[model samples]
Structure formats: C-alpha cells, structure tokens
Target: MVRVDRGLATTIGGAGVARVGYSGRILEAAADDPASGPCVGDWALVARWTDDRSTLEHLLPRRSCVTRAQSGGTSHAQALAANVTLAAVVVGLDQTPAITKIERLVALAWESGAQPLVLLTKADLAADAAEIAADVLTSAPGAEVMCCSCVDATGLSEVRDRLGDGTMALLGSSGAGKSSLVNALVGADVLATKEIRADGRGRHTSVRRELVVLPGGGCMIDTPGLRGVGLSGGEGIAATFADVDALAAQCRFNDCSHESEPGCAVLAAVEEGTLAVRRLESWRKLQREAAWVARRTDARLRAAELRVWKQRTKGSRGHPKRR
Candidate 1:
C-alpha cells in the first residue's frame, strides 16, 4: 500500500499503481482495530472487480513496522510505515536541535525493527556541525549518524549509499527539510518546499505520508512533521538508552529504580560526571511513559476479553438447550 485514506487505499505492485478499497472482512477488522487494515509500504493482495474497482484482500506479514502511540490519550499504536528497512531521522541545525526529540525519534525507529540513521540537515548554516553531530551520537547509540546540506549537496551520496536500495522512511518535525531532501535525492522538485519563518520553524508542507520511488526502484516514505511523538510500547527504550541499562545491570538491587537507591551504578555514573544528567533524566521520563502506556494497553485487553465473556454468557442464557 502506498497511500491510505478513509476507506480507500492506493497500492503499488507489479500490476501497477491502483486505488483500492478494503474487503468487507478487512473493513470490519479495521473498524475494531485500525492497525489491522492496510498501511503504506504494506505488500497486499488486491482483487479487481471491474476496470475501475478494486479491493484489498489480504495483507502479507510485515517484516518491520514504524509506529507511534496514537495522540489524544488513545492506547493504540499508529503505524507510520510498514516493511521499512531504514528510518532516516532528519534534524535541522539552523536552530538549536532538540536532543530529547532526537532521542524519541531514534527510539521510535529502533522500536520499528529498522536501522536508524540520523541526518543532521543544514550543515552549511552551522559551522560546528561536526561537534553537534558528535553530541547527537551520544544520544543515539547503535544508529548511524551523518551531517548533510542540500545547498552544497554535501553527504547526499553517502546518504543514498547508506540506504542501499532498501525501503526507508523520513521522520522529523516541521521545517526539518525532509521534503527538500527528497527533492535533492530525486533530482527534481517532486515534492513541494517552503521557506522557514524568521523564528526558524518550518511550515507544514507535506500534509500526508506518501512513498516516493527513488532512482534505483528503492522506496522512501516522506512523513509529515510530527508534533506529538508519543511512543508505543517496545524494547526501543532499552535500545536507545543502552548506556543506562548497562549501568543498571551492575546496581546493587536487580530492580533498582536508579532514584537515590543505595549502590546504584547509574547514580554513581551521574555523580562522577560520566553520564549527562539530562540523558539520564530523559531515560527516566521515557521509561515512565512506556510503563503508563503498557498499563493502559493491558487494561484495554482485559476489558475486551470481559466483553466477549459477557456476550457468550448472555447468549447461553438466552437459549436453553433441550435434551
């Protein structure tokens, strides 16, 4: 699936790109759980009823998926891109880069089961781009980091080579130059571009998530600027904060909370200046959010099960068996 709207989807396959809708069963499933339906980058089987009509029949299992917790206090995971091999997290250096935001996106990418690549944009504008890149590297462990500029066309080739004919997804906030990066990669104005305001914030240019085919038949999904990136439950936290986890392993207690605990290795590192207090705090914040999300998800599952049990009991009481 390349695009998904209300009840319709567009698919790109060997047959070609065509718009399609969901089958009745699939629609029903989606109504209950949105993630059950088709998403962009999903390989699916489509059936054609007429020259102008088609329906998505079955969705193949996704090898990897990039998802985030749904906004507005929902306990559901919103799939950003499916079957993605690489997630390129774009950050602009025109202004002060938000390290916390970078950590969040890197965690999201790692949670997707895809390799995360951090691209610091606007390198030409920042003289200390390399220094900033080094700082970001500390936050994003196990992920490749690069500094690129679209103006002088620096590091674009390296980015392409890093992608290497695999499906990649662009993740960033507004004005991060994600669309501009896409245009440079495709060598044309394939996607729209806008100028940033005096305050250095970007306008919302790309309104939706769409997949653009790269030069060598590789796929890239360009996502709109994410304002509220709530994390879905996964081991991404551990992966992103591996440094913290490693210290926790050596704590006096196996379940050390790292908050004033006696003989806590994490606290020791913080006091010794080996670890940035900011990064440790970020880890604690994300861990709390993940725990809250897990509790909500478990509650939802239990409620669903109770509903089914009640329905079965009501049905059994409605009709007495005659022997």
Candidate 2:
C-alpha cells in the first residue's frame, strides 16, 4: 500500500483497476483482517480484481516498524512507517538541537528495530555546527552523526553514502529541513519546502507519510513534523543511554535510581564531571515516559482481554448444559 487516507487506500501495481477500499471494507473480509491493515511502506498482498479495488488481502510481516506512542492521552501506539532499515533523525542546526528530543527520537528509532542516524541540517546557518553536533553525539551513542546544509550541499554525499541500498526514513520535528534534504538526495523537487516560522519552528509541509525512490537505488519515507513523540516498549532508551547503563552497573546499589542515592556511580559521574547533568536528566525523563507507556499498554491489553471474556460469558450463566 502506497498511502492510506482515512479508510481509502491508494494502491499501485498488482492487477485490475486500482480500486479504492472504503472504511471497514478490508476488515469485513475476515476477523483478523484488521491486524494486517497497511501502514506507510508496507509490502502487502492486494486483491487485483476489479471488484476488490483498494482492499488489502494481507500485510507481509514487517522486518522493522517505526512507531511512537499515540499522542493525546491514549496508550496505543501509532506506527509511522514499516520495514525501514535506516531511520535518519534530522535536527536543524539553525537552532541548538534539543538533546532531549534527539534522545527520544533515537530511542524510538532503536525500538523500531532500525539503525538510527542523527542528521544535523542547516549547517550553513550555524557557526557552532560542529560543537552542536558533538553534543548530540553524546545523546546518540552508537549512531553516526552527520551535518548537512541543503543550501550549500555540504555533507549530503555522506548522508547518501550511509543510506546505501536500504529503505531510509527522514524523521524530525516540523521545520528541520527533512523535505529539503529529501529533495537534495533525490536531485529533484519531489517534496515541497517552506520557510521556518519566526518562532524558529517548522511549518508542517508534508502532511502525509509517503515513500519515494532515491536516485541512489534506495527508497525513503518522509514524515510530517512531529511535536510530541512518546515511547512505546523497547530497549532504545538503554541503547541510547548506554553510558549511563554502564555507570549504573558499577553502582553499589542494584536499584539505584541515579538520584541522590549513595554510591551511585551515575551521580558520582555527574559530580566528577564525567557525565553531563542534563544528559542524565534527559535519560531519567525518557525512562519514566517509557515505563509509563508500558504500564498503559499492559492495562489496555488486560482491559481488552476482560471485554472478550465478558462477551464470551454474557449468557452462559442462564444457559442449560448440553450433554
């Protein structure tokens, strides 16, 4: 499925006329049909007959999925794209990149089972671009950090080289120059560009998540700017904060929260100037968010189970037993 808007699916290829599937049309086919609903970048099996236009027959198992907790007070998650191999977390150098935001996106990318790359865009706008990138590197840990200016075409080659022969997805807040980067990499104006607001935030130019084939033999998915990204379940936090994990290992207490606890290696590191207090605070905040999301997901699952049980036993108490 190339795009899914509302309940209508925009399908390309296969056979027959491209048919549009209405809301609940695909799910009505089978009880488990909803489980296989298409997301952006999903390789799905579709019925090509003229009568079955827009209906997805099945969604192939995803090797990886880029997901985050659904916004708005919901415990459910929203999958941004599926089967992405490279997740480029873009940040704008025009302003100081938020370490906490980068950490959260990197964790989400890691949790999605994709390799995360940190891209600092608008290199031409920042005099201290290198220093800002170096600071972000501490948050990204194992990920490679690259600075690129779409205007001057600096570091674009490195970005393309790193994306070699894999599906790469550009993710960042609005106004981070993700679309500009996509246009640069594609060598054409495939996506639109807009000016950053006076407040230094980006306008939401790309409203939908769509995939585009790159000139370099790889495909990419450009997503709209995200304001809030919540964590689902994954080891991304630990992976992003591996240094803290290592420090925690040496703490005298196994249950060290790294806050004012005695013999806390993490705190000790902060005191000794080995670790940045801001970094530790960001890690702790993300951990708490992840934990809260996990609890919410578990509660949702249990509630679903209880509902199923209630439905199954609705009239059993008054029914006669069959011999």
Candidate 3:
C-alpha cells in the first residue's frame, strides 16, 4: 500500500496505482488494531473485481514500520509508514533547530527499525550549516547527518546517492521543506510546495502521506510536517543516545537513574565536560515519556483481558451444559 486514507488504500502494483478498500475480515482486524491496518509503504494482496472497484484482501508482513503514540494523549500507536528502509528526519536551517525535537524524531526513526538520516534542509540560508549539522549529529547518534540546499542544488546528488534503490520516508515538522525535498529528488514539480514565512513558519503543502517512485529507482514517501510526534517506546531512545548508554554501563549501581545518584557515570560525564547537559536532559525526558506510554499500554491490555474473562464467565453461567 502506497497510501491509506479513510477506509481506502492506494496501492501500486504491476497494474499501476489503484484505489482499494478493505475486505470484511481485514476491516475487523483493523477495528481491533489500527496499527495492523495498511499504511503508506505497506505491501498488500488486492482483489480486483473490476477496473473501478477493488478490495484489499490481505496485508503482507512488514519488515519495518514507523509508529508514534497517537496524538490527543491516547496510548494507541498511529502507524506512519510501513516497510520503509530509510527514515529521514528533516529539519530546516531557517530557524534554530530544536535539538530536543530532533532527538525525539531520531528516536522515532530508530524505533521504526530503519536506518535514520538527519537531513538539514535550507542549509543555504544558514551560514553555519556545517556547525549546526555537527551539533545535530551529537543529538542523533547512530544516524547519518547531511546538510542540503534544494534551492542552489547543493548536496542533492549526495542525497540521491544515499537513497539508492530503497524506500526512504521523509519525517519532519511543517515548513521543514519535505515537499521541496521530494520535488528535488523527483527532479520535477510533482508535489505542491509553499514558501516559508519570514518568521520561518511553514504552511502545510503535502496534506497526505504519499509515495512516489524515484527516477533513478527506489521510492520515497513525502509526508506533511509533523509539529510534534510522541515516542511509543525507548528502544529508539537508547539507540539515539548510545553514548549516554555507554556511560550508564559504567555506573556503580546497576539501576542508576542518573538523577542525583552518587557515582553515576552519566552525571560524571556531564561534570567532566564530556556529554552535553542538554543531550542528557533530552534523554531523561524521552525516557520518562516512553515509560509512561508503556505503563498505559499495559494497563489497557490488562483491562481488555479482564473484559474477556468476564464475558466468558457470564456465558458459562447463562448456558449450563448437560451431561
């Protein structure tokens, strides 16, 4: 599936892109777990009844998926994309990069099981593009960092080279130049783009997550700017902060929280000027969030189990079996 909207999915196959809806069984499965539903970049089995109508019969196992804690404070995870090989965290250099947000997004990309790439867009606008990129590299450990300017075409070839014959998904906040990056990669004005305001705020140009096959092979998904994305787990966080994790391994206590704990290697690094205080704080913040989400999900699962038990008990009592 290249794109999913409402109850329909647009899939690309040998027959070309076709609009499809879910079969009854698939709809029930989706109702029970929205994450199981087809998402952009997913592969599916489709049954075509006619040229105008088709049904999504089954979803193939996804090799990778990008998910986030759904917005509006729900513990449910919203699947962003599936089967993505490369996840690019796009951030514009027009304004001061939100290092904290970058850390969060890097975690999201890491959790997706795809290699993360931090693409700094609008690099031409920032004279200290390299310096800013260096700082971002520290925030996003285990991820490649690149500074590109679609305007002057600087670094476009490098970007294309990095995306050789694999699906890459662009993840970023609004006005982060996701659409522009897609146009540059596609080598044409295939997607609509809007200019960022003087204040650096960007309007939504790509309203939906859509996939396009690149000219040189491979595919790319252009997504709307994500203002804020919640982390669903800490696996990505640990990967993003591997340096901090390495320090934590040397801590005196096995369960050192790294707060005010004595002999905490993480804090010691901060004092020794090895680790940035901001980066540590960012790790702590995301850790708390991931823990909270885990607790909420566990509770929800327990409640569901209890409901099933109650229903079974009621049925047994209401319908007595005869010997």
Candidate 4:
C-alpha cells in the first residue's frame, strides 16, 4: 500500500497493473489464498487509480502501529495506521490547542515508534509564544515544538524546511489549525480552513486520513479531528515516559503496577518531584487502556490457536491416525 503522503502511487504490481493514487492505508484483502502466506489485516487503505487500475502491492511492514480494542467488546486490536515516521500534533494559539492533548498524542506517537513534533499554529495570535510553547514542551518531554503563523511566510518556511523529506502525520483536535499548517507547509493553500468557535473549541476541518506531499519534500498525512484518544497496550506509553518506565523497573515486583506498591520507584519519583503528577496520570491512563486491549487481543489469539490445533488433530486422525 502507498503511504498517505499524497504522492502519486509508485507502480510495482507486475506487468498488468498501473499504480495511480497512493495512500498508506491498506484495506484487508477481501479474498485471498492462505496457502501463500500469513493473512493480512482486515482494515487496509484503498490505493486508488484510474478505475480498475489501482491494486494493493507490497505491504510496507509496520515498524510500529497504533491500535485499540474494537468497541464491540471483541478481543481484537484494530490498527489506526502504520509505518509512520513522525506524529506531528498541531496546536493553535487561538484558544484551540492544549498541552494535555499534545501530551496524549506524544504518548501515542512514542508508542507508534515515531518521533513526536508539536507544531504550534497561529503564532501571530498569541501574545506569548514562549510561554505557550514551553507548556507544550513540558507535556511532550523533549519533543520539537515549532511555532508558525500561517499568515506569515517566514514561520511557515521554517516548518517546511524541517518537516521536508520525512513521513509525518498531523494530529490534533478540531480547530487546532492542522489543515492550515498542512497547506502552509506544502507551500500552497491547497487545504481549506474554517473559523474556530467563539468558545475557542475546534470546528471540524479534515474528515478522513489523507496523505499529501509537501513541496519542500516530506510526506504529510492529515487525519480527521479525533473525538477522543484513549490508548491501549503499555506500548508508546512506556516509550513516551521512558524515565518513569525506567524508574519502575527498580521496583521490587517484576510486574509492578507502580500503584501503592512497596519499593515503588515510580511513586518515589513522584514524591521527589522528579515527575509531574499529570504525566504520571496520562501514563497510567494509557497503560490501562493498553492492558485492557491486550487482554482482549490475547483471548482472540488463544481461540485462533485452539481452532488451528483442532483442525490439525482432526486432519491427522482422518489420515489413519499416526502410529
């Protein structure tokens, strides 16, 4: 599947096919022969081309993936997307973005095996860019926070120069100026913008996950505004708050939950003020979601294993049971 980078699909489907439009999402193979290899995931991107021309080719192996349990209470991990290099979460100065949201995205991005970058939008609207950016940095913990006023050419140029030639995804709540930043970085106003609400909440702009190529060189994947970001699995959570994770390892219990445990270094760090209480809470929240999802995924995996064992046993018995 092509990455969401808006670049034209690079064709490699053999002699008969022509690659056209490309997106990183890989739609599950509706029909397949299992004998050939392992099954691909169900939710894959539709790499489109001139009618009947586009086809799913080589699957870009995911270096890391963002997943959550299906809401239907099934033991399944539905992947949000894959093969991302950077998780670029945008925030606007016009009462739009929050440090907590950026933190949440940073945790998710860290789990996805991608670096996190916090893009501060509408810098011109802010009276104090440093104060706001500093807050974002505190939440993101060593993430790159660049401020840009889409109305200006210089700030936009710096953003483009840095984001150029990489695979980065833009994520933020609505009215965060994600779309505007994308247009500015691409060196063209290709994306549409809308006014934020009087209350400073985001109004929806992007509707789906689409990738666009920046004129400066990198691929930018823009997604629809998220309704919520609850994570599952100890994944990126552990990575994002690595200091906490490392400290937790010093705890007495091998599987320490780091909650009220004796010899809990995590708690000690909290007591000593080495870690922020809010960050710990964010980590715990994500860890809980991930653990719940993992249990569901494990159940599904076990059931699949049982089914396979039963099939093999039945087939062997039918073949005049081995002596």
lDDT of each: 0.88, 0.82, 0.89, 0.65
- Please state every model's RMSD to the true fold in angstroms: 2.6, 3.4, 2.6, 6.2
Question: What pairs collide in candidate 2?
Answer: 19-53, 19-54, 175-202
Model 1, span 1-323: residue lDDT tens:
88888888988878888998899888887767777678888999999885678999998999998888887766887888999999889999888889999999999999999999899998989999999999999999888899999999888888888777788899999899899988888898999989998877889988888888888767889899998888876598899999999999999999899998999999999999999999999998998988988998899889989987777777798774431
Q: In candidate 4, what residue range of length 10 has the lowest lDDT sum?
A: 33-42
Off by over 4 Å in 1: 318-323
Question: What is the C-alpha RMSD, rounded to one decimal, of candidate 1?
Answer: 2.6
Model 4 lDDT, full chain set = 0.65
lDDT tens digits, residues 1-323, model 4?
22232333333234422444422332222112111111111113334555665544345456655443444545444455455577777777877455556767777677667777888888988889878888777666657888889776537777767765867777777878888777877767777778878877767866656566666467676667765665655756666677777888899898888889898889898999988888788777777777777777678678878976887888787664431
- TM-score, prediction 3: 0.95
The Cα error of candidate 3 at residue 319, in Å, is: 7.0
Order of candidate numbers by TM-score, starting with the best: 1, 3, 2, 4
Superposed by TM-score, candidate 4 places the C-alpha of residue 256 at a distance from the truth, in angstroms, of: 4.7
- What would the TM-score be for candidate 1 when compared with the true structure? 0.95
